[model samples]
Target: MSTTVTQQPQHSTLGEYKRWLRVSLYTILLLTGQCTATLLGRFYFAKGGKSKWIATSVQSAGFPILIPLLFYSSKSTNHDFSKPKRSVMITFYLGFGLLMIAMDFLYSCGLSYLSLSTFALVCATQLAFNGVATYFLNSQKFTALILNSIVVLTMSVILIALNTESEDSTDLPKEKRLIGLFCALAASATFALQHSLLQFYFEKVAKTGVFSVLLRLNFYPMIIASVGAVVGLVGSGDWRSMGMEMKEFEYGNLELTITPILAVFVFHDKIYAVKIVAFFLAIWGFLSYIYQHYLDDQMANQDRSDDGLQVLKGEEQI
Candidate 1:
């Protein structure tokens, strides 16, 4: 009887279980943060918030929380730091940090005008952007399936734009909407490119995938981003109005009242035929990618198992 290696539990070891737990916990945190952050940002705008810079800075300011994780990962072994000089490392981290700040600003700009649904659907194209970046940066070959995914996802975005009638309840001017659209797409592209660059550099140059290295890559850049945001916040003088903005925030009882309000609010997203079509089309595109990922994982596992069998058979014969 052949041993089906694929049938093995992924988290068979204690270490594997811990890793899986960490991953699941982080995934949940990320999802919660993404949803609440966007909801609050848009809520600010819907309630007459005029300070985009403040909103942008808020995103960067959260980097401090990563500090503990950096310390927690300090003991992780097998990390490969880039061999470049200190200056080079500093420059690399600073550059990416600035890119992140720019992305945050762009996202704030989008939230200023676009409806949450419209902005989110447009931003969802980042996965397709990552696919393109992987092809170019990681030397990943673009098969017909990848091309189809890119196309279908692109069409989904277009349909979202066509569903313009009920995009944002705020009803900002058309020029404002156009600006928001551009900013949203640009933010998505920047996000995809930033992560792609990090992944490519670490895997190719650093040549390690340890948790410590990954943690360092995250926290270091965040420090730079936070500092940069502070400078922007001070220079733009938006901080002057920050106190007033906070005091006057329409959702003064945000923690107490906003959760249930948004749950019902977003659920009532005005749906048009175009939006329905786009929604399903996006699901189709995402599902296709998921299935392809499963196949790749299976193939990789099978190849490893075959090599293991060959080694065992050779040892037995000897």
Candidate 2:
């Protein structure tokens, strides 16, 4: 009669709880990282850090920090680094590096000219740019919802721009305001294009373990960007400006470091909706835009099929 009472482990429930906790932590970290980067960029710009190249160089420094992680990851994972040839990789990185130089330069110029709040608000239009860029670059389908999002987002930016026109409240000069507006729009466009291109490369070219891809993506670009930044700094004779920029650089650096971690580890993606209709409208617009693109693609394919059928009929008649 030596039957002992045994307790079963609640492994499934415990594992689920751990998973939920991890997701929550990751979400918070990502939000924090994004906010930190934004604030730091604004701070650097507001603090008279006008040299875009120098600021870009400082931001690019984060890539080097990943060297150890990249090495460790390569050692630990069975990743094939030889898939993308060195020359091809260099070309890709150089192209993107040049684009990034322009984008960062425009962003810096915008920040220097516009108030932080105005610049940030204008930058929000990047989503619309992204929508268009993705459609062209990746053949991303645009649905009605996506269109709605783009419209709403674009309207919001327009409203902000209109409000900024009434310069009674601020001391910014008209010329500077105009320049800032142009720079912000240009930056958004370039950023959207670059983002779309990056996504394309990540999906098609970076067909390896995440670490190997990240290393190639970040490190090589940094080299070109660093060179560009150095030349800009030297050309502008603003080598001394880097010290002030570095003072506020830590926040941006922290953001850069945390972003990749969140991207890799975070599993549960959540969108918390507010009571604002604009927010919902933007979300729906994005959905619609994507759907519309899909519809366009389907229509194009159908047209191609019809053309092929007509060609076959003509051949038969002949």
Best by lDDT: 1
TM-score quality measure for candidate 1: 0.85
Tens digits of per-residue lDDT, candidate 2, 1-120, equal: 112111212443476479769977997997687556555565555444567666566656567787887788778877544467777778889998888778777877776676555665
CA lDDT scores, all candidates in order: 0.76, 0.67
Q: Where is model 1 poorest over a 10-residue stretch in terms of lDDT? A: 1-10
**Model 2: residues >4 Å from true position, as ranges?**
1-31, 48-50, 80-82, 164-170, 240-318
Q: Give the per-residue lDDT of model 1 (tens digit) for 1-318.
A: 134333343423455568668977997998788887888788778776888887887786776787787777876564455465677667778878888889999999999888777777787778788788888888876766667777888998877665556645657777788889889988988998998888876877666677776766777777777787788889988889877876787665356764645543553446678777877777777777666766765677678767866776777678
For candidate 2, which ten residues in a row score worst on lDDT? Answer: 1-10
Task: Tell me the spans in candidate 1 whose CA falls farther than 4 Å from its real position.
Answer: 1-26, 76-84, 253-267
Could you estimate the TM-score for every candidate?
0.85, 0.66
